[model samples]
Target: MAAGEPQAKKLKLEPKQLSENVLFGMGNPLLDICAVVDKDFLDKYGLKPNDQILAEEKHKELFEELVKKFKVEYHAGGSTQNSVKVAQWMIQSPYKAATFFGCIGKDKFGEILKKKAEEAHVDAHYYEQSEEPTGTCAACITSDNRSLVANLAAANCYKKEKHLDLEKNWKLVEKAKVYYIAGFFLTVSPEAILKVATQASANNKIFSLNLSAPFISQFYKEPMMKVMPYVDVLFGNETEAATFAREQGFETEDIKEIAKKTQALPKVNTKRQRIVVFTQGKDDTVMATANEVTTFPVLVSDQSEIVDTNGAGDAFVGGFLSQLVYDRPVTECIRAGHYAASVIIKRSGCTFPEKPDFH
Candidate 1:
């Protein structure tokens, strides 16, 4: 306690800067080629509705021939890409998205996807794989804008060794207030998830995970277990939640028991600071956190007219993270998520809601 004899300088560490409204998404970036076709088109190709067919070289050639027989359109899409797009639109703010993937050809489709990201006001930082073609998901639509078949390609090449740019972009993950990741990416490359999760956790950054598809859970059980401790918020539908619960020895029918088990799962690395939100189709959403569990009713739309349900879950994550980045109350975050999902359900694709009238 020296008074005036060259007092030692006191050092203070500055608090981490958190973005108020910016949201960051990490996943595959692909183009969605939406083709509106009639029954004749399906009959011509012996294709069934609501089926996702994998395309190889022969299948891709056949698809090209079929496209020549029918009219089609294109949009920028990817599970996480759609999430960031909706977030920017709903919040009407500058949101940033960083994707890790590699593509073989530097073609127009790739350029267009990058342009679309810019147009959506999302900061795009992608690593091109000089060996593989860019990934795409062909969504065949009916006259009513209902999707029939979703052909996923190029997205399969999202591997770990190809994404060395991730190291360069580690700063993006660290600087982000909230990091949104899709489960599909984890299924494709679990090491990428570990890298991002470890960095985000070390920086004390908020982390959110989307169960992009139910089938992904089947393939990603071990990887999911490894990253669960780093996750702070989890987004998934009833099917995905039930699958995860079953893995933990809970029955699907006993949703309450499932929720309890979900809440009680041990953190993988650090102290438990997590929330699990289980969304059911038009049913009440069940949320479980460490200290509390609750349900939030879904905002019902007129049953007469329902649109595509493609990116509803992604929109919900974006809305939830939008509020969470600002450190808003958990209740408000839930409400905002519900509102975003409602808007997307009323549209065809991963459309965003109107500017949030924050009450």
Candidate 2:
């Protein structure tokens, strides 16, 4: 059923059934070095405004230069990592309610990333590789556009046997009932993603993922397809849903049509129906299941309150998952998601308050 917003519930909230490591997520780990610089700085490093690319050999010195010259701030940024952090924040009890697996380096940056994740209460078990330094994405913000150049040094060095495949680590995977993997990991380690996803299907557990970005669908279609059959819940935004529809040859422009078709996509887990959710910023959020599609309107009282939308999407999924692990209704899940996004967009990064007054 469509809703102006998720229906308000009068019933008292149920007691939480959450336990440690109830939610599991894996993705690329990066220390985002964010700063604003002049156009001359972009030209100096052979970069253009509004372009996202891999750091080239010529740009190896760019991260150091940005830190030395610009007033930079570091944020623990990886799509899956951000979502996992938000989920834990929303849980607010049973500390370390979320377990996160990823590869980072045994370096100072890696240490900083560990500290940041711990501060958010996320149980991050990083595979600290010795061969490489660490992964970083330098966000160069100009007045007009933000240019991102990512160097997935140690992040790209993830070995399944060293982490996911290890019996000790697999125990964590077995312990969790729900799993979320960001689409960005499709670039780093599709094989590892498939392993975890396949386990979820075999064990009759919940598996979900985000489209991450339009380029993920455009460039990583093969890896994306390899894991789609195991996806029980899929999330994306308007453009991402549209781009994925095109990549999958759905041949439709209507989001509702795209959503329904995506919802009906092939899945190995026949035990549960797949849910396809697409958010259109302040517009209506679309959620489609095998039976019907529902749209929930988002109300923004004062557009002036939104300071940044950097991790809104991640917060949405995080909020959704926070409720989902406890078996809440989908409508309530969406409601919490909207609430979480609203809170995060008002802040600079993905940070939330001491506790959520979301009841």
Candidate 3:
């Protein structure tokens, strides 16, 4: 033993916490440029309320108009990033609790996104791609509706071989007890998603998935189905669940029927049955497992109290995943999800309150 050597201190986690208790997420990363606009503004720009459309070069004019005419706010955004941020906010551990990975350009927007994520207590592992500019998502919010237009420039540069093949990165992936990937990534890197899902299954980690949109469920069914067998917990909104069911050749949009079929899908390596949970806006939320189905009514919130619905579902996933990592019951997990969603809807553009009161 060398007497002059510096010693590293051991981190002592709680009894319930382990090396694998950390959460890791992967998806496109975007700098959310959010502003309030009128329905007329949407019509002028040819945008449909509540629809998320990928931005093209032609949409640059609309973005310029937004920045010129409205009050704009920027935040680190993307479905997976939002969920990971909320999970970090809920978990509240001094050591790293949640980590996210994606691609970003070597530009100002990329720098801003990474800084904001660190401020939210999330470990931001972003790759800097030089070929394109940083990505941005413009969110147009109205009194009762929101529309998103995304320009995924460098965000789509993440590749399985260049990013995920690094030995150091693979070590980090193997250490996570839980993993989450937004469905949007299926279009960009289904290979990476499959690799992570396979690893989670082999190691008995909880792998979660969010059906990002109805279009993804309807169009990207094949890749999603390949990964579903490895998913331990699955989330979707009513529209996504229905769309997935119909695309899979089911005859009904009934959530229970959808859940039953989803739950019956084969699982890999996991001994416990898969769980399917879908939320129906303002209606009862349903959860189905191999054994039974349970439904809980959405906690009532006045229409006037709801300010923005931009990141409500992402917040719910964050809350639920935080609880699930701690091995909470499904009912408690759903309650935590609802609580978090309730808090987010009162704010604008995926922003959180001062502190999350989970108690």
- Number of the top-ranking candidate, with TM-score as the measure: 3
Candidate 2 C-alpha error for residue 255, in Å: 1.5
Q: What does candidate 2's lDDT look like per residue over 73-190, in tens digits?
A: 8989777888988888888888888999989999999999999999888889999989998899887877535677889898889899889989988989889988999888998899
Q: Write down the lDDT of every candidate, Cα atoms only.
A: 0.66, 0.88, 0.86
Q: For model 1, give the 10-residue run with minimal summed lDDT.
A: 9-18
- Candidate 1 overall lDDT versus native: 0.66
* TM-score per model over all chains: 0.81, 0.90, 0.93
Error of 2 at 170 (Å): 0.4
lDDT of 1 by residue, 185-233 (tens): 7746678778777767776777778765555666677888788778888
Q: Which is superior by lDDT, 2 or 3?
A: 2
Off-target runs (Cα >4 Å) in candidate 2 are 1-14, 36-53, 57-61, 141-147, 299-301
Who is ahead in lDDT, 1 or 3? 3
**Candidate 1's TM-score:** 0.81
